[model samples]
Target: MSATTRPSWTWTIEPPDGWLVVPSTATEPADAVRAWESEVVEALLESFLPEGATGPDAPDPDADHVATVRGSLTQTVGSLVTFADEAATEGARAMAGVGLLDRGPVPVLVTVGMGDPDESDDVFMTVLGAKGGNPVSPPSIEYPDLPDGDGIKVSRVDIDEATGGAWVSVAAGRRTEFPDGVVDTALVWRSQDLVLVPTILDAIVDLLPAVKIIRSTV
Candidate 1:
């Protein structure tokens, strides 16, 4: 008898500049190929990183982290997709607010958080995309909160980890935590997320061609 494992990625997309590629590695190339979609899973966001940052996120590429990223992106995309699917969702108008550009559409940003990625003390995440106008606007959809998820009830100093030359280190962080570790009822659970959003938004703007957002008002 033989055992099997799941695939790495499931989607991919190419930008006008070139192909932002993502390959799922495994003994079974066929499984890897089937598991990942060339457009979505291999989203161009991987290519948009601070100069030194790397792709496919090695910080915590384990089963739990992988699932967290997938679930988070899925919820985000799904929520927007729903609005995209329906033209009448309330307050669903895509606003180009708080990004770098002059508020046109928006550079999609995706972030995933998990407890201590790569032995770090903080809950870690990887971001993709730049901002549209302010660069701090809320995501079209937020990631699902894990019930009784591991919470680090402490605050730490923010550090700069820019090793990739040419591009400055946009991805830096310290320990972040709400006053209370209980997330479900905590309003400020993801408060620190505010600081890390622009890098992600920038990545999205650079990589993705156009993000179709439904406008409820229009």
Candidate 2:
């Protein structure tokens, strides 16, 4: 698509207290990877080595431990980079961030992306198909306060694996028409805490209003 016709939108959200939002421009894949890695490493270090744990001066983690943490995160870094790249290619803005759920410090991946107006349905369905499992209707999420369009459709899918047992994936998508064009937004996140689905969904609802469409000057 030409620059003037490209779909553009901005997403802003105030993550819950424990949650962290790793900002991303989606224009550079490498930058996204580095930002995510940096945020995660810091969060991990804080959780593992709480402030003032060792007397008045908290000891810093050794180089070896830091290296090990980065090494372990390498496996997932590529996926995040790919996600950011794809969003950029599709003329969409996206953020690939990590969330700290109630279940310990197990990092949860949260992605918010805005895509071409014409591909709104496809974007929503693609997220729902991420786990290839039956979609469970998410808690009633209505955005009556927002503009009119295909209201958001949210699905909760339970993914089971031989090694990982089971985890819950939530995907929500909405297509809203702006003065320029129809812009779609998708929010997806995975967590092992099934009981927190409602809370997560509520968060998603709170995030939708923050989406602002960028009108192309050309």
Candidate 3:
């Protein structure tokens, strides 16, 4: 699609290298994934309608939406990782998908859920409140211009005590004129080893800039 053509779907970011995709399994986060699938379909179908067109004028986008959502689920479901035990899981799971990175000695679970109808900062607050943790840095970080969207907002916090890892939850999303547009989120974490934090943070920073929006013209 050309730059002028708006994306019918949303966006995705490249996970850091060495981070292998998790294999598909009947896991705890399946419910969250399914919810995301439903949201994606709904959003895509809404996008299919012409600017002012709605109701009968615009053909039902369900068939196309279903096909797209199913394709997305089949392609990415197995790769998702989740940290449900985390205090933020309750909120994070409600917004987007979650997943695990198995490349390091310890598996780092993160919330891969992004592009909820709400702003990233709003989502972050909800997640932080649900998790009930101390602020790691400032409550948020602002990026004036992200790759695809208008701007980006991120909220982060350090989890008080997580198993054997240094845990942090980050909720972020890109901005758009449409209030209903999708925003993204990532819960970043690494082994308690101080040395690993820098590398992990660097990877997270790299991944955020790589996020791309794939628009559907169908």
Q: What shift in Å separates residue 100 of candidate 3 from its native position after superposition?
A: 16
Q: Summarize candidate 3's per-residue lDDT along 1-218 as a digit string, tens digits.
A: 57776546554445454333232213346676566545544443444334534444545655465556456554433224333334233433211222223222223333433355643455544542333446566555555455555443344545456453445444344343334455444444433344444444444444544455454653
Per-residue lDDT value at 197 in model 1: 47
Point to the candidate with the largest lDDT.
2
Better of 1 and 2 by lDDT: 2
Candidate number achieving the greatest TM-score relative to the actual structure: 2
How do all the candidates rank in terms of TM-score, highest first? 2, 3, 1
Each model's backbone clash number: 31, 0, 8
Each model's lDDT comes to: 0.29, 0.52, 0.43
lDDT of 1 by residue, 46-123 (tens): 433233233455454354655555555444433433332232232111211122332211222222232323353322
The residue ranges of model 2 lying beyond 4 angstroms of the native Cα positions read: 1-36, 54-56, 59-100, 103-144, 147-150, 158-167
Clash count for candidate 2 is 0
User: Where does candidate 3 stray beyond 4 Å?
Assistant: 1-16, 27-120, 125-132, 136-145, 150-180, 209-211
lDDT of 2 by residue, 1-218 (tens): 66556544555545555544443446546565587766666555455543544333545655556556455555454445555456556554444333435333333333444455655355456654433344454333344354534646454555465665556665555666675555555666666777877766666555554544445533
* Model 2 root mean square deviation, Cα atoms: 6.3
